[model samples]
Target: MHSTIFSLLVLKVSSGSAMKLRSRFQPEAVGSYRRLLCSLAASTHSVEESSMKSTITKKSIKSEILRSKSPTRSPIAVLQDWIKSGHKVTISELRFISLQLQKSKRYHHALEIMKWMEAQKGFQISSADHATRIELILKVQGLTEAEEYFSQIRGTANQKAASLPLLHGYVKERAVEKAESLMMKLNELGLLVSPHPFNEMMKLYMATSQYDKVPAVIMQMKQNRIPTNILSFNLWMNACGEVSGVAAVEAIYREIMNNGNVEVGWSTLCTLANVYVKAGLVEKAVLVLKNAEKKLNTSKHLGYFFLITMYVSINNKEGVIRVWEACKSVSGRMTCGNYMCMLSCLVKLGDLVEAEKVFVEWESNCKNYDVRVSNVLLAAYVRNGLMEKAEAFHVYVLEKGGCPNYKTWEILMEGWVRSQDMEKAIDAMKKSFAMMKGCHWRPSEAILMSIVEYYEKHGNFQHANHLIRMIHHFGLASLPLYKVLLRMHINAQRPAFNILKMMVKDKIEMNGETSACFSSLCKRESARE
Candidate 1:
């Protein structure tokens, strides 16, 4: 027992030696070392438990998103369910879901997510949040409601967040007058306005070929003491390169390059190259592109693609291939967008085999599969007159659990029609109408024409009527579609008076197609007489 006690004392002395630094406060220490260890273990367990709970929350949120049938309604319902269940949804979580919705082009449902956040208890949304909501409204609603929303909420937010989004919307709609007036109104309010809005307006003018006004916009920026960003300067340089020559371009470039406050951007260099190209200075353009190439970030697929695009503009196929090879050498996380860009380039180059390989690589890896990517290949096949191949590939895609959208079926219909297979085209149309749920999913003119011709030849007025009724039911309007139905009825010697009445009730205007169909009806009646 003496020996055991001596050994225990030795161990205690060793441990005590390790604790010498804390010895000064030992009298004030609240717990023994064992108790302190227990507290630390408990703390670690609590952290692990919180981590597990967070994982579960994320899973529940995802599952909720997957549970709802409608994209437009799903997010809203899930958010409401969370609130009702006393689950705390973080802003980051909300933004993540909103980002997914935005990427999927589901603006209405994204808006619903924002709406839920706004309605949350004791939540004060930033101007940025309100601006995001405005952007969503612009997309799902329209310019009018977006403007109304901006005007109604201006008193509560900063000018940048409130007005800039609307200005962007106007730029999209090409509403020059409205954008200018809004800018003027913002100026009158004496708010802190940035050069970015003016830059956007200037680009709009440049796109519309109003080169003279670009300088005025730049002058306004200078007058306002707004720090002109590289992008705006690039736009100005592009416009001024023709009128101001290489000297002016070089002077400003040097100024921007020397300014310690200003950082030179790749896009700025690209714009400089574009200006050189416009001024008949191919060598100068090549030099600018070389400088851009030197600054090219290999990890960014878009940068390489942009370079490839510019090379294509210069008609430099070899340069494009070299840049593409460089892009392939980069080690990084390749996104869906990168795959899409590669596919697009390959398709443009008629490298179908390469495209398919690139496509398969993405197809195996991508979780959120978009049918549009598949359609690009489908259209490629159809354009090459490989209808059978297109159909077979489409079937393969569907069997592989691909989400076949309306455009997918539309491409199928178009391929059949292009091959003059009216029977198959009509069948495709029937399938399209059966599944048509929204305005964006309407069949093309070529698809509709194939159906109408098939109906006219088959004299199946019943089927034609059904097809027309379905098209209008989905809110897809086309004068040609209506005219074809009328013509088919007239040719079938069936009473299309009811069809005409339906058109009148639906307020279908009589265009050239409708008028020609009516003229055909008159000729048929006279012949019968």
Candidate 2:
């Protein structure tokens, strides 16, 4: 029993000592642990110390830690260690460090690091992004610095890529004068400005309405022996339409024809047509469309829309119908706006029969479309004085789950008023207002004015007065609208005296224009009373 107790005591003491030794040698306590172990190991003969064994274990742990190259150290920590250890950073490693700094948008620090790299010698980092970053950083900070850097590229053997983005950046900033100067410098540098930059320069000059520069740019093509294709001619002709008359546009067209190797394209003809359209020469617009068709050997729908729009602008109903028929023949899919344009034109011209045919053909052909198309078709019907057909068409549209918008209702109501169907017009106007109100869109002053005019035209002064009051209530009355109201009352032969008195009471100024004509009439009425 005594021997067992001695053994147990010895084992418990050793275990406790081992635990304390482990706690001391933890990585956090490595310095303390090393010092204690070094001292103990030096006193190897001490009776209470197992110094030699502990020393061996601590040396093993130190070796293991030293062998493990961990990545968890902070950048500052690694840098500090490198400085303390007097380790030299290699060129490749320094480049990577610069890249890391650049990625963080620390360009100034990156430049300093790069300068350090250059000072270290035998290090050449000439990647595109590296060069671009230096230029971009300068460009962002100071334009003069960027320009200086750009000028240095001629002397540097960096293969002339520096001018490309500099030119592009200038163009993007719309620094046209600066870009033109850069273009001259780049051309003088004997670096062939790439096609993309060439196109950009062309667009910049074109946008500024510099038609003179157009020919000059094209002349550069000739001097540089750059091929002048159909696109080049088209660009010039399009530019001419801005400052030059039709004659100048035709001269460019003739110039394209004179250039035997390059033929005029459909796009060129389209531009000519657009120029004529702007000049309000409808026949010329049609002729251009026809000529393009002959040259291209196809009637493109784009040309058709342009021709139709031109016809509408000139109020050429026959031309519109011709274009509409042409559009219908060419079939894959068409925009509803295109068809609506034709329908609206036919309605405005009072061609009810042809308009009906168009709607029928549209419904028969197009399988899917929005409700607005049907609404437009309804408006077209009403505008042509086809009330019976318009009502039937409205029913057809509703059956297809299509809701008519306020414009459609307004058109039908106007048609009713024109036909002297005052009761129906009033009812339809109320229904339209209710629908607009439901959808959180209010009726415009124009719609209400139309209602008031309709009532006055029918000699229902009381109804007209009610509508004028409603206009005020709905907040639809503006200065111009108020003038329109005063005129309507005067034309209806109603007593404008009371309204004029009210205007004076409200302190609304009656200018010379209003008083010049109505003032004498008001004075005569007062004298009679």
Candidate 3:
């Protein structure tokens, strides 16, 4: 009896011939099947509605956060408003928002979202979320704080997952000792079940120039029966290239091709090609690059950029143009990064005309003006001693509503300094300093010294004093600057006592030249008295 009902249901669903099923089955069975069909249809509609709602919710939340006036604005406030507006916040939505923030490099905002999630009642934060929060804390705060947070949750079931980010942080900082100690601890805890931790250790070893240790890492992986990933093989190939040569890299490549567990990727082939290029085996490099091109994922631009860079390194202009055209063909509308890469390669190859054409294409299609894109051409102009063109391009950028970044002013300052236009150089330098204030950037000592020499030669005491104060404000004051100041004071027959006091305060050591300058000033003062 049950089989008869099941057959009737299948016939109704497959053939949708309800009259035939009705003729075979009892009226009661047909009525039950109708109810089931209604239930299934409702369930599918409900799922589609939920999916649509989820997509809309994600878009709304992302827009709210991105539209905030400042990066420091609390994302929690956005969530509160979202909740107050008769909307529910799901864990999935919050996680989605956090991931988006992370991709945009807004770590502080991402951390705020994580904190909000932890505070919510009945929301079970997964181990992966905890790991993400730890990584965000490492970025927003420091490694010390991240380590402290990890210590509190070190004994949890998913401690292995939580610890990987910390290990990555250590590798990023090149803290070899801490990384090795953590690896030892993880091994003792039996948490080294995957290739991630081992790959990170290999990366650390390579970064610290301990190339010989890379093979030991691979051997350990083998002994532990941990399968290697694409990154593992790439790093191994690079370390081999660094330590041994092209032969060693090729051997590893052959092994990778044979290892069914690992899929040979475009990036792996690119790494091998790079090794070949370094060894001056252009023919071999070209062959590997062709293989890499075959493996290229058409959706991604990274491989194309890497190929262009390799071609540039080998002075293969035709190869660059071919890959570039291929990239454009695949990507109907190119990105700013794509244009910049092509422009830079063309400029490097002394194909300024082609560079200009590419720049114009970017300018025409770009929604918002990116000064960096223009800066490439501006720099090329300045680098080749075309100051007039550089100056004109700088004005053109301003006219096009492009804001100059620190690098723009830096290039202009360097060009002006080279032309011995001290006044313009000083102006550009001041602008550069202003742009670089509170940033990690510092002007090169060579440029600073050149400006100092200019000031000293012209006996420009006022500007020299201002420059010294600016340098001191930026914590860039050096012995050379103080020495130049002392000489200027001595030459101007002004009192050098205050300058001497500043040197003492700054703990600038008195070298032979400095001492001699001070002595000359002292003797002249005595004569005047």
Candidate 4:
């Protein structure tokens, strides 16, 4: 038998498949095989003194088998022969083969061998006995097939607590539905239930956005008398925040507060604030965010950033200020985002004087200003009818970085018009147009109209007409912007005939404003002609 086992091992080693060459015999398998060989060798000994020589011979055979690179014998046949000869091979040896087969992704073969081992005398395979082996199978193959095999032993009266990886497997497969059903089945049959499985199932429900099902899953856990932990509560809160909106989130908060043992953390408050913001309840969002800061004993820098944004969305000036103060408190120096928020909010509220003050404050602290912050301050300047300040800051940004961004140029152009500085405004617009030309970015029709309006506002018809020519040159003549120039001519009360001639020259379309303006300009122009 030993000689045949040796020959088989040699054959397997020499002509083995790629799979065999790559096989990593695990330590457990090696240890178990060694133990089996020792047990088989021990069985060859006799109680009589002279029979010790036979024991030594058996040890020599076992040693030879161990030293051989591949098994020369059929391990299963050798084990069966030992059992038939009335010697017991350890169950560990059977498990080693099962694991090896499973490791090779040969699940069907592994399962078959497992069944054969179970049918053997004194060969009871406990789930606890094979948890590690089964976990290996699950990792190598996958949860779906692993769970099918698990189910065969999982609900048996002899089964221990379900494995952790199996619980995680349910989550990975997004099979919370199956987990919920199976957990209940396990409990109904008086099986030892594990809380991890229920927790994982709840997590799975959370991942799939089926938050509505979480309460039912939690109830299932409760029915099974499994203790809920912090993770369970957080996932429940997250689910509520998703489907139930702020009201549900508030209820979750109340429950957490009532639980004296579990103090609320910063993340909980952040979540509450987020839900409140989503629900469009800005006041409630700010209030909850503030309370969260107090409760967590943390600064409100991050919270204030979100708070200010919500307020800005609703045009809540006072709320914006409050949030800004909180932000400043958190970070002593204002960030660019905070500065932009302040500038934008002040401009929208029509507090031009305050806006001017902020612009100057930003410049005085120029050493601390980020280039983006400087750009926003320029926009604020332009919006507030402060062209000179806008130009200075635009230059500042260019000196600090490169040229001002598109927004900076746009704001400056708008500011130039507001301050009745046409030539500089037109020059700025032309420069912006040139820059766009360089970058393969074109000014929209609206920008051209803004420039035309600037010229018309300053009563510079020739320059406005020149801009009209430029608009046509850029193939923007068919656009609606030329109408603004026609309207400007009529509003200027220029010679109406001359304005009409200009319109005819440009083929400008006439809308109500343009027609009326053109008629007015024509009456004046006809009198002059």
Worst 10 residues of 4 by lDDT: 18-27
Candidate 3: count of backbone clashes, pairs at least 3 residues apart or interchain: 0
- Winner on TM-score (1 vs 3): 3
Mark the 10 consecutive residues where model 3 has the least summed lDDT: 17-26
RMSD of 1: 20.0
Write model 1 residue lDDT over 1-529, tens digit each, in one string. Answer: 0111111211211111110011111111222222432443344244544554467553577457644648546677677777799877766566556656766787788788888888788666666667778878988899999888777674634445657668777877889778777766766665535556676676666556555566667666676677776656776666566455667677778878887877776666776777676667888777788788777776666667777777666766566767777887677767777777767777787779878987888888788777778888888898889999998999888887788777777888888888888778777777777676553566776667677767767788888788777766666646777777887777677666766776776787898877777777777778888
Rank list by lDDT: 3, 1, 2, 4
- Residue 103 displacement (Å), model 4: 39
Candidate RMSDs in Å, in order, are: 20.0, 29.5, 16.6, 23.6
Candidate 2 CA-lDDT value: 0.58
Number of backbone-clashing residue pairs for each candidate, in the order shown: 0, 0, 0, 13
TM-score of each: 0.66, 0.46, 0.80, 0.39
lDDT of 4 by residue, 1-529 (tens): 0111111211211111111110011112223323433343234222322342344344332333233333234444545555687765445545554545544565554554555666777766564444443455566567777677666664463333334456556766777656655655655565525445555665666566556666665565556566665555666666666665666667877888787756666456655666666567778766765665454223435445544554555566676666565555563555556566677677777666765676667666555546556666667677667677767767766776544655556677667766767677777777776665556555666657766766666788887877776766665664366566666656665444544555566776677866666566657767877
Instruction: Count backbone overlaps in model 2.
Output: 0
Query: Residue 140 of candidate 2: its Cα lDDT?
Result: 49
lDDT of 3: 0.77
User: Model 2: which ten-residue window has the lowest total lDDT?
Assistant: 13-22
Superior candidate under lDDT, 2 versus 4: 2
Clash pairs detected, candidate 1: none
Best by lDDT: 3
